[model samples]
Target: MKPRDLFVLVGIIGIVLMMVVPIPTVMLDVLLVINISLALMILLVAMNTTDALQFSIFPSMLLITTLFRLALNVSTTRNILSKGEAGHVVETFGSFVAGDNLVVGFVVFLILVIVQFIVITKGSERVAEVAARFTLDAMPGKQMSIDADLNAGMINEQQARERRKKIENEADFYGAMDGASKFVKGDAIAGIVILIINLIGGLIIGMLFLNKSAAESAALFSKLTIGDGLVSQIPALLISTAAGLIVTRATSEGNLASDITGQILAYPKLLYVVAATVFVLGTFTPIGPTATYPLAIVLVISARRMQTNLSRKQAEEEQMEEEQQIEEVRSPESVISLLQIDPIEFEFGYGLIPLADTQQGGDLLDRIILIRRQCALELGIVVPVIRIRDNIQLKPNEYVIKIKGNTVAGGELLLNHYLAMSPGFDDDSVTGIETTEPAFGLPALWIDEATKERAELASYTVVDPPSVVATHLTEIIKKHSYELLGRQETKALVDNVRESYPALVDELIPSILSIGDIQKVLAKLLREKISVRDMVTILETLADYGTYTKDPDILTEYVRQALSRQITLQYSDRGDSLKVITVGPSLEKKIAEAVQQTEQGSYLALDPSSSQIIYHRLNEQVSKAIQTGQQPVILTSPTIRMYLRQLLERTMQDIPVLSYSELEPSVEIQSMGVVNL
Candidate 1:
C-alpha cells in the first residue's frame, strides 16, 4: 500500500487507542486542535462538491470522524476527573470563552448540543432517507430510457453502459448516506452524556483525592467540564453541518458558491425593488438611518452597476455569435465539412417545413424513426440518420430524397388534399387534380377532404400527404440500402453475430473469406431485395463452402440455395403456391453457351443481336403476367440463374430471378408463362 493509505490506517488505530491510553496534557491539546482542523476541512470539501457522487466516501468518513470524536471525549473526561486539568486548549476555552461564570458556560454548551442534535442532524437524516428511496424508485425508468436511446441509435453501447453505471453509483451512495446519518445523531447524544459525567466526576475526585475545599473543587471542575464540552461540541457542530450540506447538495453545473451567486444574481432588475425596500425601512423606521442608510446607498449603487453589466454582457454575447459565424465561413474546416456527404438526405421546400417541424403537429420525424426501425427488421441493416432540411430553390410543394449526394427520387404533394387512386376504374365525380403516384407511378387524383370520404366509398385508395412522403422515403431507402453497407458496416454486422456464434465467425473471417468478400455477398443479397437477417444460416453456409470458392457471386448462389425455405416463403402466395414464368431449355442453353470465363470471374458475352431478341421475348411474357395481375417472377435452372439475372438486371431491376434449387419442394409451382428463343 501507499504511504498515505498506511498513514490513514495507523491514524484510525491510534484514535481507537486514545480511549484507553493515558494521554499527556500537551499531546491532548494538539489532538484537540487537529480535530477542529479536520472538521473545517470536511465542511469546506462538502460545500465545493458539485454532485453528491463527487464525495461518495463521505458516509464512511462520517462514521470514522464520529468514532474519533468519541475517543477524544473519553481521553479528556479521564484527564479532567483524575488530575482536575484537561489541557491548555481546554483551559483557554473555559476561562477565555466562559469568563469565570459556571452557569453561562454550561448554558452555552447545552445550546450547541441542542442545535446539532435537533436541527442539523435530524434534517440530514430525513433528506438522506428520501433521496435513497427516490433514487431506487427511479432506477427502472432511467434504465429504460437508456435502452430506448441505444435502440434509436442516439447513443452507442459504451455510452449507454456508462450512464447505467452512474445511476447505480448514485443509488448506492444515497443508501450509504441513509445509514451513516444515524451515526451523527448518536454522536450528538453521546456528547451531552460525556458533558454531565465530566462535571460530576471531576467535582467528586477533586474533593476526595486532591483534598481541595468544596468551593475550590466546584469551581475547578465546572471550568474543566465546560472547557471539554465546548471543545468536543464545536467540532461536532461543524461536522453535523457538513453532513447536512452533503445530503442536500443537488447535481449542478457549479459548486455551491458559484451556483448561489449566479442564480441569485440572475435577475438584476429585482435588485432595484430590494434597494427601494431598504431605503424605505431606513428613512421611516426607528432603527435609525445611520445604520441602514449606508447599506441602502450601497445597494442602490450595486444595482445600477449590475444592470449596466447585464446589458454589456448581452451585447458581448451577440457580438461573439456573429464573429463565430463569420469565422466559420472563412475557415478551411468549413470547406472540409462541405466535402462530406450524408448517406441519406431528405430535403423539402420551405412550404413543407411543417411536415418536419414538431411544433406544427407533423409526425414526419417520428415516422422516419419507425421507417428506420422497419428497415432494420426487413433488411437487417442499421440505416444511417437521414438528414432533413429545407431547400429554397425547389417548388413550394416539392421534396426530394438523395442517396450519397445524388437525387434518386422526388415528388410534389398538395398538403390540404389526399391522393386517391382508381381501382382499375375512373371516378369522374371524385376528382380534383390529376397526378401520378410517386412511389408506384399509378394514376391518381388529389382530392380534397370533402371528396376523401366519397372517394373511399367509391372504391379508391386514398392516402394523406404525410403518408405519401413516408411511403416514398421508405421505398427509396430500401432500394438504396445496398449502397450503404460498406466494409465498416459489414464488420459491425460480423461483430454482432460473433457475440453469439464466436466459433463460426472465427473460422470464416480472414481465414476462408475476408470482410470485403462477405460485404460483397451481403450487398448482392440486399441488391436482390433479400433479408440477411438470418445471419446464422448465411454464415454457416459460407463457412461450409467458403474454402472451395471465394467468388462472391458463386458464393451468393450457394447461400441462396441454403436459404431456400426463406425464399420460398417470400415469393409464394398464402405460403402454399407460387406462380412464375419458366425459362425454356433452348433459351437457357443459348445463355449458358454465351457466358465467357476468365481468371477474374465469369460474365455473359452474348452478341448484341441475340440479347435484343431475348429482351423482346422476356418483356412480352412479363407484360402478359403484369396485365393478368400476377407478380413477374422468372424461374430458371441453378446453373444459369446468376447469368440470366445479370442479363436482365439493367432492364428489369425489380424482377426477382430465382433458381429451381432455391425453391422448397413442399411448395406447389404453377407456370404462368414461358420465355423461349
Candidate 2:
C-alpha cells in the first residue's frame, strides 16, 4: 500500500485501540495535544473554504474525529479514576487555565459544552437537515436546467454529464452532513456524562479506597474531573464551530474572511457614519479624548484607506478591460473569426428581444431548447446549437430563422397580441389584423389579449409571440433537418447504436457501407420526415440489403419498407382507415417506363408534356384529398415511388409519398382519389 493509505489504516486501528488499551501519561498528553491540533486545523479549513463541496469529505472527517475524541475521553477517564492523574495537558488546564480553582474550571467547561451543544451543534444540525431536504427536492429542477443548457448548445454532452454528476455529489454531501451532525450532538452529551461519572467515581475512590479526608478527596477529584472535561470539551467546541461554519457558508469567490472584508467593509460610508456616531457619543457622555479620540481617528483613517483601495481596484479593472478590447480588435485572429458561421442562427429585432431574454420573462431560449430536444426525439437527429441574437437592421418585431447563414423563414409578431387561427369556419366577430401563419401560411389574425377568450370560444388556436416564432422555427428545422445530419453526426449515431447492437453496426458500417453511405441513407429517411430513432431496426435492414447494393436511394427504400409499420402508425389515427391518393395504373406504368437507370443513379426521362400532365393530375387529386379533410398521401409502386416523389417534391413538399411496399399488411387503405395522365 502507499504511505498515505498505510498511515490512514494504522491511524484508524490506533483510534480503536485507544479506548481499550491503557496509555502512559506521556503518550496520553501527546494524543490530547494532537486531538486539539486536529480540531483547530479543521476549524481553520472550514472557515477558509469558499464552497461546501470544496470540503466534501468534512462529514467523514467529523465522524472520525468524534470517535477519536470519545476514545481519548475513555482513556483519560481510566487514568484519572485509577492513578489519580490523567496527563500533563489535563493537569495544566486544571491548574493554570482554570487558575487552580475547581469551581471556576467546572463553570468554564460547562459553558463551553453549552455553547457547542446548544448553539453551534444544534444550528448546524438544523441547517444540514434543511440543506439536505432542499438539495434533494431541487435535484430534478437542476437536472432539467442542465438538459436545457445542453439542448440550447450552451454546453456539450461532456459538460452536461459533469454538471449532473456535480449535482448528485452535492446532494450526497448534504445528506451525509445531515447524519454526521448527529455525531457531534452525541459527542456533546457523552462529554457531560463522562464528566459527571469521573467526578462522582473519583470522589468515592479518593475517600474510601485511598483513605483520604472528604475535603482533600473533593478537591483532588474535582480538579481532575474538571480538567479532563475542559480538555475534551474545548476540542469538541472547536469541531462544533467548524461544523456550523461549513453548513452556513454560502458560495463565494473567496473565503469567509475575504468575503466579509470585501462585502461588509466595501462601503466606507458606513464606517464614516459609525465614526461620526462614536464621536457624538464621546462628546455627549462625558467620555475623554484619551480613548474615543484615538479610536475615532483610527476609524476615519481606515475608511479613507478602504475608499482609496476600492477606487484603485475599480480603475484598474476598467483599464484592463479596455486594453483587452483594444487588443482583441487589433488582433488578426479576431477578424478571421468572423468567417465562421453557426449551424443555426436565430436573429430578432429590438422589440422582440423580450421574447428571448430570460430577465424580461422571455422563454424563447428555453422554448428553442425544448424544440431541439423534441426534434432529437421525434426526428432522431441532434439539432445544432441555435445562436440567438439581436439584429438592429431588421424592423422591430421581426425575427428570422437561418440555417448555415441563409434565411429559411422570417416573421413579424405583434408583441401585445395573440395569433389566432380559426379551426375551420371564419370568425369575423373577433376583429383583428389579418396575417398569414409563418409556419404553414394559413390565414391567421393578430388579436388583442382581451379577445383571447373570445377566440378560444370560437374554437380558434391561439398562441403568444414566442410560441409563434417557436412553431415557425420547429417547422423550418423539420423541413431542413436532413441538411444538418452530416457524416460526423451519422458516426455519432452509429457509435451510440454500437453500444446496443454492436455486431449489427460492425457488419453494416465500413464493411458493407461506409459512414457517408449511412449518412445519405439516414438523410434520405429524414428528408421524408421519417424518424430513424429505431436505429437497431434501420441498421438491421441495412445489414440485410447493403451487400447487394451500395446505392443510398435504393438502400433507403429497403429501410423504409422495413419501417413501414412505424410510418403507417405515424400517419394513421388509431383504429382509423388510411386514406390516400393513388396514381392510376396507366400513369404508374408510363412513369415506370420513363425511369432510365445510369451508373450514377436512376432519373425520370418522361417528356415535358407527359410530366406536366402527371403534375396537373396529381395536384388535382391532392386538392380533392385536402377538401375531404384527409392528409395528402401519394401511393405508387415500389419501383416508381422515388421518381414520383422527386417529381412532386417542389409542388407538393408537404405531401408524403409512400410506396406500396411501405404500408403494413394489416392496415386498411381507402383510396380517396386517383391521378391519371
Q: Which ranges of candidate 2 are over 4 A from the true structure?
A: 1-310
What is residue 201's positional error in candidate 1, in angstroms? 5.4
lDDT of 2 at 541: 90
Cα-lDDT of candidate 2? 0.90
**Candidate 1 weakest lDDT stretch, 10 residues:** 195-204
lDDT of 1: 0.93
Candidate 2 lDDT at 214 equals 83
Query: Which lDDT values do the candidates have, in the order given?
Result: 0.93, 0.90
Off by over 4 Å in 1: 1-92, 95-101, 114-213, 239-254, 259-330, 334-340, 357-363, 366-384, 417-434, 443-464, 487-516, 572-579, 624-630, 666-677
**How does candidate 1 fare on TM-score?**
0.72
Instruction: State which candidate has the highest TM-score.
Output: 1
